[model samples]
Target: MSASTKPIGSARGPAGPLESRPVEDSGRRGLTDRVYEEIKALVMDHGIEPGARVGIESLARRLEVSPTPVREALARLESDGLVTKRSQAGYRATELLSVEGLVDLFDMRRLLEPRAAALAAVHATDEQLDHLETTVEGMRSHPVTGERYLVYRRFAALDQEFHDTLAAASGRPLLAQAVQRLHTHLHMFRLNTAPGDALTTVDEHDRVLRAVLRRNPDRAAEAMEQHLSGSWERHIAVMDGNPAKK
Candidate 1:
């Protein structure tokens, strides 16, 4: 998940020296972010056996950057309930994200997203619809990258954009803000483990767009639920793939 990746469109200087400029520092935040996103993305993408301990130093060294940002990113992941720190294990990814956890997340999305879409149906601009449609389209051609086992990092970015649009289309500042938080957390899960289960997701998003555009609240809600349910079953299958040890 680490690269001394140059800023967008910037030519890589001699590979030996990792540049450290204030402007570069601003850009390094981008790397730091990529570091975080990549690791988390790997978690979802690779389905790293949950509860497997991951070493920050190892990851930092592997990514080819300073450990400071990696530390910061891991802490943030801890806050999100995705990664945890144990006394001896250092930081390990959570393997068994419970079925209860999955069902709860789906419930929240079901309750909130439909309302948001219904609002958006009336309030959304044609421009917003066009923008969302574009983002949805981008997901189709997206590619996977980052550390081992976890590749959902790319799709995670796409999912975030889509839900944010869904909220913005609603045009209710308060609701959008609230939904944004939930969506962020939801994206964390959906994106984290999306790689292995993407075909189901592609079909899912296709249906969502069709329904949302039609401005059918019931249909949009149903589509969202169906998509998430498929995801939950996939995760449950993943969980069963490594049945609980006695």
Candidate 2:
């Protein structure tokens, strides 16, 4: 992605200047929410490059809104870990995860997720198992082909939901919260545009779900480990500039 920090408002689309889009409501909160989604999309889509400074006034001008809403949006983004505030400089998009960061992230996952899956095998309610089945089925419909993030955004969302539901079903609130805080799917999707191994991902999720549905703790744990290992390899391949094998 380009490191240039261009004004978001300068780009015109089929509709018009993004700033020219209408807000749904006249309420202050509504305006702020709209601004938040707009800016969030920019950040997520890398319209603003990683580690690039975000100018409040420029964004406000581009969005055709006051600085107040932009500031509010930035604060919310900060909580989401998409941006960071500096002491005196300003806000900047969070940098892409480094190789070491990726390793640490997977370390945490391997520590928590397999255990969570094992617990889920013993503790998941019928509803939660159904939800997992539904989510995996949903994923199968969203066939990912190219390297565009937008193309596989739905798959990414469902993938997150599958892991999250499994964690929640472990009957451990702390574990679920910890996994959510990692924001694993968001960071992984943001790491690069390559939608790594969608078909293989679906198959892996199916294996994990089947094990959980059968209430086999050892099997579930094993499946989860394999899934994470495969996922880590795919991401590492992307980072090394190789197309992940499907």
Candidate 3:
């Protein structure tokens, strides 16, 4: 049976249904950055299909920004692996991850994240643990609602912050950098989402957080491995003979 199909540890199963609210942007970022994030959101929410052309003029008109910022935003997205630039065709939304790419991504994550978790258990300060707690709280505070797209967006950001904090807690800059480069959670959101998936994710995170709080390196590593492995299986199951399926 698939790992995702297997029950997550009984202690860390899904909680009650999530009741998410619309994700609120604080409007703190500069215009260029905001434009970049908005366009990126369009791609991630599948508002723009994989491999479809991204017309800068149209985007600029919609966003009410100059074409310069739109072009700049596309260039930045290209670096994030979400946009691709064809030699003569300008930019298009990048294709979703292939099965092989998914395997490779999880493989690299398996190698790096567990080690980071183990180190985090050994080195995390009280302040770092509190920061981790804050991120998890954010996830739990917003339950899934009718705003599925917004729910996914909020969950993905919180998830990224959670992992990024965990990696930083390792006190090894290079190791943390490696984990950040994977962009595991961001890409995973691009794959598929089911109703209970967010709750399951929070439960899995709680396990890791508990282990870390106890400063148990072995348990922390084990929990991290299970989390990543479960995520892999869930994403793989959503593949309907394509990189991603709605």
Candidate achieving the largest lDDT: 2
Ranking the candidates on lDDT from highest down gives 2, 3, 1
Select the stronger candidate by lDDT from 1 and 3: 3
TM-score of each: 0.64, 0.84, 0.81
Predicted candidate 2 versus true structure: per-residue lDDT over 1-246, tens digit per residue: 233246443322122235357444478998998888777767766678788888898788778788999999999989878899999989999987878888999999999999999999999999999999999999998866543444666887898999999999999999998987888887887775454478899999999999999999999999999999999898888788743211
Query: Which model scores highest in TM-score?
Result: 2
Which of the two candidates, 2 or 3, achieves a greater TM-score against the reference? 2
Backbone Cα, N, C clashes tallied per candidate: 11, 0, 6
Query: Which ranges of candidate 3 are over 4 A from the true structure?
Result: 1-29, 86-89, 146-148, 240-246
Candidate lDDT scores, in order, read 0.62, 0.82, 0.76
Using lDDT as the yardstick, the better of models 1 and 2 is: 2
Question: After superposition, which runs of candidate 1 have C-alpha atoms over 4 Å from their true positions?
Answer: 1-27, 41-64, 75-81, 84-95, 143-150, 183-197, 244-246
In candidate 3, position 178 carries an lDDT of: 90
Encode model 3's per-residue lDDT on 60-116: one tens digit a residue: 666666787778889988877888898988888877788888889999999999999
RMSD of each: 7.9, 4.0, 9.6
Candidates in descending TM-score order? 2, 3, 1
